[model samples]
Target: MDDVKPKVVVDPSAGFCTGVKRAIATTEKVLEGDGEVFCLGELVHNEAELERLNHLGMKILDKNHLSRTTIGSHVLVRAHGEPPETYKVLEDKSVKITDATCPVVLRLQQKVKKASEEMQASGGSVIIFGKASHAEVIGLLGNTKGKAYAINKKEQLDSIDFSKPIRVFSQTTSDQNEYEDICNQIRIKSSNLSNGNPDIEINNTICGQVSRRGPALEIFARSHDVVIFVSGSESSNGKYLAGLCKSANPLTYTVTGTGQINPEWVLNAKSVGVSGATSTPEWLMLKVAAEIEAMI
Candidate 1:
């Protein structure tokens, strides 16, 4: 039995990406000071990290709560960049805004805002290929002044008026291939409507960090007999990475933490690989690997 114990390996590529690392580091640094630190949203999608931050006296606030924010209170924006309007409102209130927006997201927002401004003059519209209510998408929509159309599924393309000039931008963390497909569909539809050339501008705004994960995780998953994927339920990256792992290895199982790990899943596995989303903490993944070792 000792000789037959499954060999477990944690994926080297798994854990928080550069943006998440920056956000977490900024939060820790802010918490070190003797002041009220309010994060605009969950700094990271991982519940354990949130718990740790909460224990450190970091307060998480939503949009509604943010509206009621008192003047002079310190607010930390997460990696998902907010709209210019949010900054304007916060500035108007004299709130100390510590922006921790990811550079990639910041660039995307700038591009979207600029494109939307250009299109606004021409009676064109901005369309976002992403989850409608996602935090990042919400921020992206803010650049369009509430006029951007968010299409999460291919079927939603029908809602777009192809006759008008269109500019498409994707959420920084959205699936790259899916975004390209959506843009292609829009281009085809617009072309048919115009009988030749379509006035469509496509912006590939997906973060390179997110764009590379699908293929990297696929290889990691295929290298093992069974893959243990860790991520929070509400994390978009978590769901996307887990799906990639599942597609690569049928024996893949997703768990938010160690407690969710099923012994049965590890029983007969010869080799086990552990991986997580961009928002997942390395410490959490280490703990998960230790739990799997204990089970074996």
Candidate 2:
């Protein structure tokens, strides 16, 4: 029998982003301590990573679940960040807080808040390009006193009154191309309205980390016969990355862990590639690669 060897190509962008790295590092540090450590939310989007950390004694707590837990416990904030009110509620319960919000997101939140305040002062509306229900979107909206409007598609731009001045921004992990498309549509619509005002101000607030992943994943996907895209099912960016790969190569498969891999996907393929989202860990990808190698 001929020795079957599978070539594995890993995406350059397939590791933890700065925010997720920081959150994981903090969680590891807390786990080393003597106290009972609790995470305000999932430390990262990857289920495998969460499960590994949970094994180390890190407790994941949700809003309702947190309500049932004892007060004055140590709570670590995840990368997605929380609204100021969440902190206040925690404080009321005397919970000690350790924040691990992604620095990029932290900066974006500050910029959104500051820009919103400036817009409110100048009688302009704050418009965000993002999923309305996302926790990050909620945090951004909270900065605007609930006055901010979210636009997920080009059609949402029509709801805006062009007569009024507008300031636009997006969630850090949003699709960059979509963000630009919406901005262009808004500008074109505002131009035709003849509201007797200046040009609509559009701010490209999408993070460079998220924006750079598209091309990277595209290039990596093209070099392999079969591509495996790993990410937590809950991660929007992970799904987007997988979609990019699928568009580039029809043989792309999305999985949350190594156990999801089917040997049949690589039966006739020699060069198999693996990639993951910013929230995914490098160790997980290596494990998946090892699993594929064993199958060969």
**Candidate 2 versus the native: TM-score?**
0.93
Q: Write the per-residue lDDT of candidate 1 for residues 40-86, one digit (tens) a residue.
A: 88888889889988999889988776678887888999998787788
Runs of candidate 2 exceeding 4 Å displacement? 1-4, 195-199
lDDT of candidate 2 at residue 219, scale 0 to 100? 85
Clashing pairs in 1: none
- Taking every candidate in turn, the Cα RMSD to the unseen true structure, in Å, is 1.6, 1.9
C-alpha lDDT of residue 126 in model 2: 83
lDDT tens readout by residue for model 2, 69-161: 566678888888777778877888887788988887788788878878887787778899998888788778877777778889888776777
Q: How accurate is candidate 2 locally (lDDT)?
A: 0.82
